[model samples]
Structures are given as C-alpha cells and as structure tokens.
Target: MVFKKLLSAFGVGGPTVDTVLVNPNTRPGLALDGRVNLVGGDAPAAIEQIVVGLVTRVEMESGDGEYAGVMEFHRLPVSGAFELAPKQQLSIPFQLPVPWETPITDVYGQRLHGMTMGLRTEVAVARAVDKSDLDQVNVHPLPVQERILDAFARLGFRFKGADLERGHIRGVHQTLPFYQEIEFFAAPQYAQVINEVELTFVTSPQGIEVVLECDKRGGFLSAGHDVFGRYTVAHTDADRVDWVQVVDGWLQQTTSHYGGLRAQGFGAPQGFGAPPGYGAPHGYPTQHGHGGHGHGHGHGHGGHGRGVGMGGIVAGAALGAVGGMVAGEMIEDAVEGDFAEDWGFGGDEE
Candidate 1:
C-alpha cells in the first residue's frame, strides 16, 4: 500500500512525499523493496535526510494498566543531503530487511486477527517539520510456521485468537520487546485434558523454536495449571516431517503429565526436540501469567476465513466449525490510534 502526505511543516505550498511499497507482503529475514517519491513545493528546499521505518502496535504492561502503542523497531535511512528546486521531483529506493523474529501477520493469505504491521516514511527538510506517512504491511509466515499451524487444524485445534504480550518469555532468546501468542481452543479429544493452548515461535536462520503452553485440566480435587512444552524444528523439516503427528505428540506429552516433566528427567519427545519446557532454566515455571481458560473471548470469528484446504496441509475440522465467525472489533481499534506528532524523527537542521 502507498501513503502520501503533504509537508505541512512548511505550511501551504510546502513539499510533499509519496511513499510506495513495491510489495507489502513479506516474511521474516526477507527484505521489503520500496521507494520514496518526493516533490518540491513552490520554493526550493534543502533536503536533509529521508528515512523509512517498520512500525507495529505492541502491547505493553505497566504497573497499573496495559496499553498499546506504535513502536518503530527497524529504521533505514534512504537519503542523505540533497536539494530540491521548485517543482523538482526525487525518488529514493530502499531495501529494508525484516527482522528474523518478526511476528507473523497473515496465514495462508488471511490476515491474522489482532495483528497490525505498517511502514512509516519520514522526510526531513531543512528548517521545517518532518512530514510522515504510514502504509500497512502484511507479513506472512515462514513455510515451517504455516505447516505447524496447519497441523493444529488437522488435529482438531480451533483457531481462537492471537495477540502480542508485553513481557519477554522467561527462556526465549527474544529480540523484540513483545511476543506473539497464537491461541487455539482444544479439540474434543484433547478437551478432557486441556482447555486451550497458546503457541509462540521464535525464529532464526537455523530453525524455528515452538513454544506451547497448555491450560491443562485438573483431576477431581485438584486445581488447574499451565503445562509448558517447547520444541525446535528445522526449516528443512517443513517438507519432510509429518506436522500433524508431531503436533499431536506435543499435545499428548504436554497434557499427559501434570507434574513437571524436567523434574522427572522427561524431555520433549517430539519434533527436533528440546528439553521439555525450554522457556526456563529448570523447565517452565509453575507461575506463568496465562492461567485463564479463555473461551468465548477474543476474535476467532468470521473476520478471516479459516479456509479448509487439504493437500500438503489439512485445515483442521475445528476451523471449519468456527470459520464463519466474525473477527472482533478490537483489530480495528488497534489500527486506529493517534500517531505522535514527530514520531521521534528529527527535522532537517541545515
């Protein structure tokens, strides 16, 4: 998508900027190619610099409340010093690298509800305010990620909702400030053992690390708690492994044990395998914040079609059941917010 904005910093007849992204759809570790088109106004202006940044809405937790904001995580300077005569036009190109740990915004061409990503363009003209524009960006999942998500559906796990949490997971080698949690409702067979599950993936060049936090059910006279399971899968495995079997085994092992697994020397027996509960030093702690059995909460509705496709990947039956549900209004809320006047981008000084 392209966004154009006038340089109101210089008042009427000031310069304007039109930022165009060749393609907004991309994956982690890939580069987004785009160009910044600038047009001079009535008067000649000395351009100081032009920059582009990748921004997203990140959820944050404070002492008293939780809030979300537009965070500029990656910045790229597109132009240095330049001069634009009256009616002069300039085009500067850029190749911005998407971070390896970037969160996934779309699955199988469908936007994941609750996720919002964008690119911001800032042009700094000498002695004037910086003009800015924002464009939406779609980040698709890596092949491995798609395979895992597909497996969940094939196993009867229903898509619940996804969100970015404020804090870093205890053991995750996190690069970004927040983590994305793709949630799912338990299938009928696993429902007796688990209420729901939250999934997270920390990706690197070598492989992707999958984290599963299952809301395990308690037996008679027992209280329910979360059982955390962590697994690592190589990208090459996307074409070779049976993700459905792998994911099913993960669910089985996670719910099969109420007592901690690491404590008993039991480790992850699925996927590429990491020690059980790899999110912590001694396995997952007993006190994870996600202890709620969140059914009937969040958007898993009709916003994005949970299309049933069965070829290499099988969309689970649960998705077909909830496929028609509407996405919640929260996604719109996340996209609609007031951006900062300056966005921390400095105006041209010379």
Candidate 2:
C-alpha cells in the first residue's frame, strides 16, 4: 500500500492515476480510445472529476520576443465524480474525438521534425490539489494530406522541419487557435528563384485549404520577400489527377510574376487555369508577416545540404522517413522533459 501511494498533488494519502491509450496512433477526425486506471491511497479521497485534453507546443509571439509553450487545444470530460475507499481500484473508459484541423505529428510511422503531441489526463480531488498524467500521441496525415506531401517529396522538396505558430491567416477558416507550417527547402529547379517553401493545410470534413509561402531570393538591387498562394482541393479529387503535375503547376504560378500581384493583396490572376476539380488560387494574407506573428523561431534552414531530395532518400519508404529516426528520438526526449513538466493547465480551473 505504501508503494502504491507513489505521488500526487493531494499530499501523501491521495489517489494516483494512470491513463493508458488502447492505440496511440490516430488520424484527424478520428477518436482515441483509452482507459484511466486509478488506485485509492491509504485514506479515503473524494474524487470530484476527470478530464482529458490534447496538448501541443506552439510558438507564440510576445512583446519581448517569440517563445514556445504548451497549449491545450481541446478537452473532454471522462467521469463526473465519485468516492474511492482506501485500497480500492477503479477504471474509467473514454473516447476522445480528434479535431478535424488537428496538426499532424506523424506521417507513415515517422515523427515530423519539430512537432510533439500529448494527451493529458487530469483528476480533481474535493479539497486537495489535482493529479495529472501525460501520454504521447501520434497523429498521422489524412489520405488527401498524404498525397499532397508525397507530391512535394516527388517534386524534390527536401523536408526542413515543421512547427505550430500561434496566429490565424487573414482569409482561411481555422478552428484551432494555432496552425502548423511544414518547412521545406526549394528543389533544384526552383532554387534560383526561391530559397524555401512553407506548406500549411487547413482541413475540414469536405476538403482542405492548401497555403504556400515561397521565400523568394534577393537580386542585386531588391531585397528578398515571401510570396503567398492559397488553393482549395476536395477530398474526392485526391486520386483523380496527377499530383506531381498539379503541384508543379502551383509552384510555377506561385514563383512567377504573379507574385508581384499577390504582394499588392490581389487574388489569382484571371484566366489562370487551375488543375481539374481544384479551386482557383487566392492570396494568403498572414496576420503579421511571413509566418503569421513575426520572424519564425527555432526553424533552422542551415547546415542541411541539398542533395538527392527527400523522395530520393526515402524512395518507396514512408512519407517522412527523411528525418524520421532523429525526429523520433527528439520527440521522445521532449516527452520526458518539458512536456512532462509543463502540463499546460494548472490547478482545477481548466
């Protein structure tokens, strides 16, 4: 009994909780099935409520500068209230629905670089502090998302990294407070005009809104700047057309003289032919500048060389296999480090 009373915010004789996910791997618009196991401490405790939430690290802008912090985007109640006797045990099963716009942390079993997700379980006691548990969660891409990412790889875009920014796009519909940006180095073909590209997907039940930000290169007299493009695609068209050609066309249009029009806050040029079943391009006006808030932090575009491209390196392999192993280890370290220490929500209020 003494050993069972490991740790809790309700002092020594308080209940301890452990949340176990039946299957940690899931996709957007899906549900995560799990059970919460609780063991009563040496004394009887009045358990008030139980809750679970989805949390992730988001880079936010402050007056001083930008910093990364854990934010709980969604939460669900598991159990109402109960009274546990000493040495008693109880199990509560729950099904938490993943948001349609949830940022993907994994692709084809590979953890995306610079991304981390966790499911947090919090138990409230009547008159004592709360006890919480954290579990790592892997969110894979939807079918359409997978296809688009595959197209980028095939187009010779090398994966740089990915992170969530705390802000909204001026024209896109977003449910979550923050959005994710998957960064990539420009392919050899477009290297002369653009330095890199950042991809953002705003998904819903019917389809997705694809946003692209191209970092154009600076010439002798002019300084470089970012060009934006927004396009819509239906889920049904995921397999109806050749993605390579479609994506290539998008890059060409985005990096062309059309960028000059976007800089002036204009939509796609008239008579611009979009791919079959795809919506015409629109201008993406980020809240602040290039990356929503301000300059992107923690995303390093140096040291990594341009070579065989991401697709060639992981030919026939998983979608994000380019830096999967290293990213996996990095996620694990985060789970044990900052993620564990910072549960995001403090006390019984949240």
Candidate 3:
C-alpha cells in the first residue's frame, strides 16, 4: 500500500547496522579488527555505502571561546552500493589501521580521565535515514610514553587531568591536527615555586617530542608567568635513562630561569609579550647523568580541568567512576545524532 512506502522511507523498513570489534583494545600504528553485521528490514533496499571511521572528541578554538565536539580523523570504506533483500543478513569483515599519532585513552591499565575514543559505523541507504553504531576503543601509550608517565609517578607529581587542544606547537613536529595535554599538580617541594605542570607529547616515526609548561607562582618582586620546556627522546630511549632525574632536572631548569628573565626586565605575564624561554633557561643545566639537551619552553594557550590523584595516574578514584558516564553521552551523540552537522564535516557523504 502507499502507506507502507511512506513508513519504509522513514527507516521503518530500512536495514539495521551493528559493528562488533573483535578486540576493542589497540595501540598506535595498529589495526582494529571488526565486522559489520547487517539485517535487512521489511522491504528490499539499495545501500549506498558502508563506512567505518575512528572518531574522538577534540577541543577547537572559536571566535569568542572554545568548544568541544566529536571528529572522525580517519575513515575506511568497507563496502559500496549493494542490494539487500528483506530479512537478509550480511557480514562484512574489516581491518582499520589506526594512525601512529592516535591520542592515548588509557594508561597503566586504567582509562585516562578527560579522554574518549570510539569506532563509528555509518550506513547510507537510498531513501531512509542513515543509521550508525559506536563502540568505545582503548588506546594505550607507547613504551617511551609509559616510562615517562611512570617516572612522573615516581617523582611524586600527582596526575591532574588530560585534554586535547587544537593547534600546533611552534617547535614540535605534529602529524595530527591537534595535541593532548596531560596535567599534574606540583609536588610539595616545588609547590612554592610552581602551581601545576602541563605535559604534551608530539610523536613521529623518528622520535617523540616532549613539551612541558610550568606555571610559576608570583614572588615578592616579580609577577607569575608560565615557562615552557621541550625534550626529545628516541623510541629506543625507553629504559635507557632515569626519567625521574631527567624530568626533575627539566622542571628545575624551567623554574630556575625565571629569576634571570625577571632581572632582564622580562616583566610582563602571558599575552603581554613576556619572554618565552625557547631553550633551557640561560644558566640552568640542561643535561642529566646522560648527555644531550632537553627541549625548552615558550608561551602558548588553552588547557583543561585539574584535580588531585594517586601516583602518576590521573585522579584515579573519581576519574575511573565518571569516565564512562562522560564518554557514554558524548559518543552516543556522535554515532546517533547528526555527525556532519555537529562536527562541521559538511559535504562528507554519510
């Protein structure tokens, strides 16, 4: 009947799609294995295409302020146009290669707070509303990253929070459109000189560039300002040096340089043309027991929330409890709602 055609056009008789990942856990430069299971509905239909994309939340800077939304960084097409008979079932296997620069979502077997990742499936049919499915994904840190994080834990710095910032650092080689900042509160000894520290890692096939931003407290004579530091480490450097000492030295150098800058009349704070220390502050030792200079710091913008937590792991108890809730709602919208409309991916065919 004519009424039946109207109902089918509105998805009442369209195909349903479900994506199942064999293993949701993955790492950078790896492949995600999964299958798209489809069940045809009340009437035969023509499926325009089936696409699987890796989507995650990214914070972007706008005219007035910043806003966060889901973005599909990489996409893979599994199937093209196909005819589906009513009630027919089809299974399509796929292996999606995750990029080497994928932001990490889990650390030390625990989910990092303020991070979310998912796999989304988009199925477009001839005359029905498109349907999608989302699956949470876990991306673990690389070996070098793990060592540095564990070192932070060993150094008494507590994890605060993490977030993705849109923009590229001046001196770092960044492959992705954005970068991640993992923040931590200052330990007792450094508390008087600094408030918190934000750590960022820009990775590449050759090595990883580690950036540090230390927020210093104001002194009796000088105003407070953030100092930056950057360090480069090879993937093979894991287990080769004492990261605790290296990190400590970097922090010390970053904080120590303020006195010299202040004396040089580098008086203004951020946004007022304050001196951004591009290398180890002038006179601070840049080397550890091993030789080679660590990267220095400079001024930048934007960050996320902060909190207290146990050794190097981001505010564990509360973060572990609330992570699922945050990811659930955000990712649900990404897969179910208007993807193109929400993320400004205009003209990207479903």
Candidate 4:
C-alpha cells in the first residue's frame, strides 16, 4: 500500500505516499475504488498528476522457451494540476476502469494462487519530488463467468491451473501482448475425446469470446491429435446459455470435425496455420473465429497436472462415453504447478 517515490529527487525530508484500495476484489467489467494519501515534505510543491495502473503477471514466449514478468496492462490519470503545502496531507480518490479483457484471478471464492493484481499509483510533482505506490488487487468472476464456471463444476471437470500466455492463438485479435488460459480436466462422457481441456475468455464492449481446446483420443489404429472450438456468447447469454449443453455441443462438434484433419473449429488452433474465414481473435466480434483445420495447436500443457476426484457423468443415457471421468477439482495444480516451464508463464515483458 505504500507508494515508492524517488526520495533523492526531493532531497532530504522528502514526502512519502501510501495507496489504499477501498475495493481490491472486483469483476471483469467493474471499477476499482481506491485513495492515494500523500504526505508532503518540509517544502510546498505543485502536484502535476496522479496516475493509476493495473498490473498483472503473465508469460512471454521465446524461441528458447518462455519467461515471466509483471506487466502494467492499463493506466489512467486520476487527477492533475494540484498543490500540496509543506507538511500538508492530501488524499486523491479514484475509480479506475477495468478492461473488458481483464483476466479472472479467482473462482468459487478461491484465488488462482499464482495470479496477482496490483494497483499502481504514480504522483508527478514539480521540483520537490515524485512518487508511486502499488497495492494488490483481486478480480472475481463476472456473472456470466460464474455461470460458465458453475456449469463446469456441474459437468465434472476439476480445476487444474490458470495462467496468461504470450502470443496469439493464430487467429485471435489480441490488443494485449498475451491471453489467459484456464485449464481443466475432462469429465467422463468426454474422456474418449481426449485428456484435458483449456478455456480462454476474451471480452469486449459487445460480447465475450469463449475458446475451448480438446485433446481427443486417437482411433484404434491412429495417434490422436488435439481439436479446438470457439463460441461467441454475449453478456446477455449469462443466464440464457445452458452452458452445459453449449459446452457439450462444443466438445462434440470440435472432436467430430477437427478429429485428425488440420482444421480448427470456430477459432484458430495453435499450429494449424490460420482459419479461412476467421480473422485475428483480439478483434473477436469482427471475425468470430473458431473451428477449422487446426494442426498441432500451440497448447503444450499436455496431461501432467493433477489427479481428478470421482464424479458422476452427464445425465440421461450415456452417449459414446469412454475412459474414467474426473470430478471438479479446485485449481490446485494451476496455482502450485510451475506454468512458466509448461507454457507461456511470463512472456509479457519482452
């Protein structure tokens, strides 16, 4: 909560800062409320501005592999042209806007463990000195996000891990340098389809982009390849989508179409080159990419995370179900496991 300023710039008896966030935990589209307390030095000074930034930890991709770093995702100016008299106290309250694509750091009231969000406050002063402060912030799931998460729990995919990765999904139009990947183990019905699944949600003013990747089983005489699918659901769909049915459909459609071919469904698959109809993913609503010939997509997590607990499969008659299904597990492996080694853990800096 303490702001760090260049004391040397202000000479001796320099002022100090501490930023207190009234509401650290918030949703993707919610606002962050906080106040910056500034204690002036022995001399009076003209304050230039107060800046707030949202910082996140993300993985970067490199030819040698991946790396990690704390990157500032967004910034806003809270105030400007102010004055702080000698030995005077000033408080600057601010409500910063959260980006629509902001990553979700928690689910079911559980912190993703490895994930961390910080509010950085920067104070600009004339000659006396300037200082900045950083405080931790927590991001909760959106209503639609919660609906989808609960559906996953109901469907029996245990949580494994979650992290942001550098690089595009071949066809995603990303404004930021990286994207977040929420990994989950497969349920019983979808077992034969593959080992696990990774979900990514990209949002904008218009709607959200849901990406699903499935690691399907190879045929009796063939090696199985991974298949991916994407869905464009609007915020209004939060209560409307039978996520269970929608997700199930996605899994089935993805596996059946991209089975072993080079096609990726709906969105771009890692290495399948690019989809014919889909443009970049960042500009999602514009392209609505998912499904098509997706070669060996860029997902390198494999099936090395954690073990799943026993859970019942989907309701009604069992379809072409196979393999032992996994229950909904908390994000144990994700928060504890080293993502940098497995995927793009922290590739944002470079």
Candidate 5:
C-alpha cells in the first residue's frame, strides 16, 4: 500500500520521493520499517527537512451532529539539512514504532473491509515545507487478536466490517481523538438476544481495552438497548495464548451480563510500548440515525459507505431471519450521498 510520486506539490524539476515500507502487516508493539528514496527530478536542490506523520479519518461530535475529520496522531522527524545534486539518488531508511493503540487494518492478510491508513510525507525547503506523498498502510492484528476473531468465526459469528471511530468512550483514558471499531454478526446461539455487535479497541502499554456493543432488535415482546462490555489483554501472551477459549469466555460472560453496565477485570500488563504513557486516544460520540435499526450515523461514511455492503456482520444478518439490519453508527461504511456500487466485499452468499 505504499504510494510514490514525484514531489508535484513543489512543482516540476523538484525531487521525486517514493516510500517503501518493509512489511505492511504485523502485531501490536512491533516496528514498521521502510526506506524513503529520493531522486533529483532535474537538479539537486537544498533539502532542509524530512517528516513523516501517521494520519487517519475519525468521527467528531458537534453541536449539530457527528462529523468526520482526519487526525494526525504520531509524527517522526527523519532527517534534516541535506543536499541533493543533479541525478543523485538517496534513500533514507526509517524504523519507527507504530503507536501501541494504532488501529489494525487487516486480518490474516485480508483487508478489514473499510479501514484506511496512510503515511504522509512532508518535505521542507529552507523554511518552507511541501506535503509530498501519501502511502496507504496495511496493519494486521496481533496473534491474540487473530485468535479471538477466529473463535468468533468458528462459533458462527461472521465478519461484518471494521473502521476507525472518532471520540472516546465515557470512562477511558484517551490520547488520540478516535478509536477503531470492528462489527460482527451474532452467532446462531445468540441470535435471539442481539441483532449485531460492534467492537472497539483502545490500546496502551498494559494491553488493549476491548469494547463490545450489542445492538438488540426490538420485537413483539421486547424493545432494544445497546449493551456494552469492556475488557483488556496482554501483548506477550499473544504467542502462547488460548485465544479461542478466552474470546469464547468473553462472549459468554458478556451475553449473560444484562440489566446494568458491566466492567470486569480484563486489563493486563504487556510492558511499555514506545513513549508518551498509558492513555487511549480520540473522541467521537456514537451517533444514531432515526428509525435506523442499530448504532450511529457515523457508520455509513465510517466504512466504504452504505452501498458497499461494507459491514459483513450486518449483511450476514440479512441472510438469516435474525439478520438483515441497517447499521446505525460508526460513520465507517454507511453513506447518504449517491452510494456507489459495492465491490470486493460481496458477491454470492458465503
């Protein structure tokens, strides 16, 4: 997902830059390395600075309603005060730690439906700077994360869709202005209790804070409510983990947890992850659209927008009686504009 192009913003005859990341996918608390290659377009110019920033689109709550904005959470200064001569080619190598709370972009080498990430390059000339390239980054889950997901699948919970969310949960330590949400269809055993489920991860050095939102469907005998459950996990245990049993435990524990808000002893230590300290990031309030069966307004744009059938979990519900639902929030996949045709996500029933 790396993007390379001539530094067009600086005009013609400027240096062209291309960024190639070593490997796009890895678990949490790992390093993402790559090289930034620079080639003189016409002649070498004085290069003053090279900067890289991690950016993502997030939802924001406002007086009117929920909106989307890009949040640049982490930045690194690679090099400074360098010169490029005509026909000169230089590559700057970078090895940086992705924020412990960085969102997971893929699962088992597959796209997580609607998640998007980019590495933006900024080149400085003298005192001025030019935004150069945007490299689409693909990040996968940690081993433990994968195991939990596999358990859900094996238990018959189909993958729905995943996307970064804006804002913070009510009682969480947040540093960034957004979080990541992964939605899932209910497993057959729990179909009668919930229509769909939305998952969010807020990570820190200790581990990841897992937030689960169960969207209950209104029926003749019952109304609906959004049931939330939060938990944590350690990093080192990912390798030697019993993820299937652990995740199943979470589902079982949470499903039986009704009536009032529930918070359990799930947080664990995984050592320090980079710098800054332990705190979650972002702030996007869950928005709800009217008559919409499930979550919030952010759901549409949060993913690839509505037409894409972006969220697989909600779509899976449509395949069954307890299925077929309109996701209410997250702003990740649903769209209100002229929705485009869905591709890559759906075709025949799986």
Candidate 6:
C-alpha cells in the first residue's frame, strides 16, 4: 500500500511525499524495500530529512485502567538534507531492516485477530509542517514458530485473540519495550484445569525463546492463578521434532507442577535439548509478580467471544474467525487516524 500527503507545514504551495512499499509481506530478520517519492509544489523547498519507521498499537496500564496507543519501535533514516526546485521530482530508495523480535501480524494468509502493523513515512522540512504517510505491514511467522502454532491447533486449542502488551517478559531478552501475546482457549482435554494459554516468542539469529503463561482454573480448595513456563528451541528444529508431542509435553509440565519447575529454574524437560550456545535456564515468576512494574490486562481489538476451532485452523481456515474483515478495515483506519494523532503529526505543531 502507498500513502501520499502534502506538507501542511509548508502552506499551500508546499512539497508532497508518497511512500510506496515494494511488497508489504515480510518476516522477522528480513527487510522491507520501498522508495519515498517527492514532488515539488509551486515553489522550491528545503528538505531536512526523510525517515521511515514501524508502528503498532500497544495496550498499556495506567493508574485507573489500561489504554491502547500507537508506538514507533523501529526507524531508519532514508535521506538527509536536500533541495528541491519548483516542479522537481525526486525518489529516495531505502531498505528497512526488520528486527529479529518483530511481532507476527499474519498467519498463513489470514490476519491474526487483534494484531495490526504498519510502516510510516515522515518527511521533515527546514521550518515547515512535516508530511507523513502510513502503509499497512504484514509480518509472517518463522518456520519454527509456525510449527508450534500448528501444534496448538492439532491439540484442539482454539484461537481466542492476540494483542501487544506494553511491558517486558521477565527472564527474556527483548529489544523492544513491549511484547506480543497470542492467546488461546484451552483444549477439551485440559479445560478441567486450564482456562486459557498465552504464548510469546522472542526470536534471535540462533533460535527462539518460547514463553507460555497458563491461566489455571480454580480447584475446590485452591484459588486460580497463572503459571509461567519458558523453553528454548533452535530454528533448525522446525522440521526435526514432532511439534504436537512437544507442545503437549510443555502444556503438561507447565499446568501440572509449575511450582516445582519454577523452583528448579530448569529449561525444557529431559529429551528436548537446547541448541548449542543457548543461554542458561530461563526462570519466569508468576504473571502478576514479574514484568518489571507488573503486567496489565490487555484489551484485545477483536471480540473475545468468538472461537476458532483447531480443525479449522489446521485446515487453513481463516484464523481471524472473529471478524477478520472488520478487523482488517479497522487496521487501515488506525493507520491513518490513531497513528497520526499518537505521533503528534495530525494537528498543529508548537
């Protein structure tokens, strides 16, 4: 998608900018190739700089409650100062390197419920209002990550929703200030004890750190609480292991006796080994106790009542079963509305 806007700061005869993405679909550790096209209006103008960044909506906790806002996490400068003559046209090509820990916005061709991502372009003038544009961005999952997701579907776990939380996961390395949580309703076999499961993936060149937060059901005498589990898997293991069995084991270990595992500070159970050069055992505290300043309840964008069955998901049915079309339209609207307001570029600048 492409977005074009006039330089409002420059007044009537100001320059205009149009950002065009070569392709919107990409994965983590990849690059989004695009060009910024500029056209002079009726008069010449001095261009200060041109930049592009990745933006998304994140749920943050406040004193009263939680609110969602747009945030730019990664940016790259495309061009420096330059001069444009009357009616002159120029194009600046750029390659924006996606971060290794970038969140996934799409799975199999279906947009994930409650997830939205975009690439924003900003062109600053010497003393004029900066012109900006935004285009939707789609990020797919890595092979290993996809395998794990498929495993969940095979296990009868239903897709509930997903959202970005403005906080870090304890005992995990993160380049950004927030993390993505893919939530799922519990499968029938484990519904007796588990209500839902939240999954997080922190990726690197070597491998990925998988974090699981399980919401346990209350027992006759015990109160309900959240259990945390962490595991390490290599990219090469994407095709080597039976992901169904592995994920099932992880769920069993996590929901059964997470207290003992937390005390031991261990990695995955025996037989599931971490790749060479992997870090030490990852120990995660209870959900409410960690995350630096405590985690907030996420307000997902899509309706939470809709449920996506495992059979449908595994068969390539639209994963956005919870009104994906509506969610997609909402994403586009957010790109032009929420992003501009949050970035402080929609109104007058001081």
Per lDDT, the best of the predicted structures is 6
Model 2 backbone overlap count: 0
lDDT of each: 0.63, 0.68, 0.66, 0.58, 0.56, 0.68
Off by over 4 Å in 3: 258-312, 315-317, 320-333, 337-350
| Candidate order, lDDT descending | 6, 2, 3, 1, 4, 5
Model 4, global lDDT: 0.58
List the pairs of residues colliding in candidate 3: 228-297, 229-296, 229-297, 230-295, 230-296
Best by TM-score: 6
Instruction: Give stretches of model 2 more than 4 Å off.
Output: 1-10, 261-350
TM-score for predicted model 2 compared with the true structure: 0.76
Model 5 regions lying over 4 Å from their true place: 1-10, 63-65, 127-131, 218-222, 239-242, 257-259, 262-350
Tens digit of lDDT per residue, candidate 3, span 119-228? Answer: 88888888877778777777777656766776676667878877777668876666677788888888898999899989888777655778788889999999989887
Cα miss at 139, model 6 (Å)? 0.3
Residues 142-182 of candidate 5 have per-residue lDDT tens digits of 43455456556656777777655666777777666667778
Count of backbone clashes, every candidate in sequence:
6, 0, 5, 44, 41, 1
- What is candidate 2's lDDT per residue for 148-245, written digit by digit as tens? 77778878888888877888887888888888999888889899999999999888876788888999998899899998877777655544445667
> What lDDT does model 3 reach?
0.66
Provide TM-scores for the models.
0.74, 0.76, 0.76, 0.69, 0.68, 0.78
Q: At residue 140, give the lDDT of candidate 5.
A: 56
Residues 62-89 of candidate 1: C-alpha lDDT, one tens digit per residue: 6767765555667788999888877888
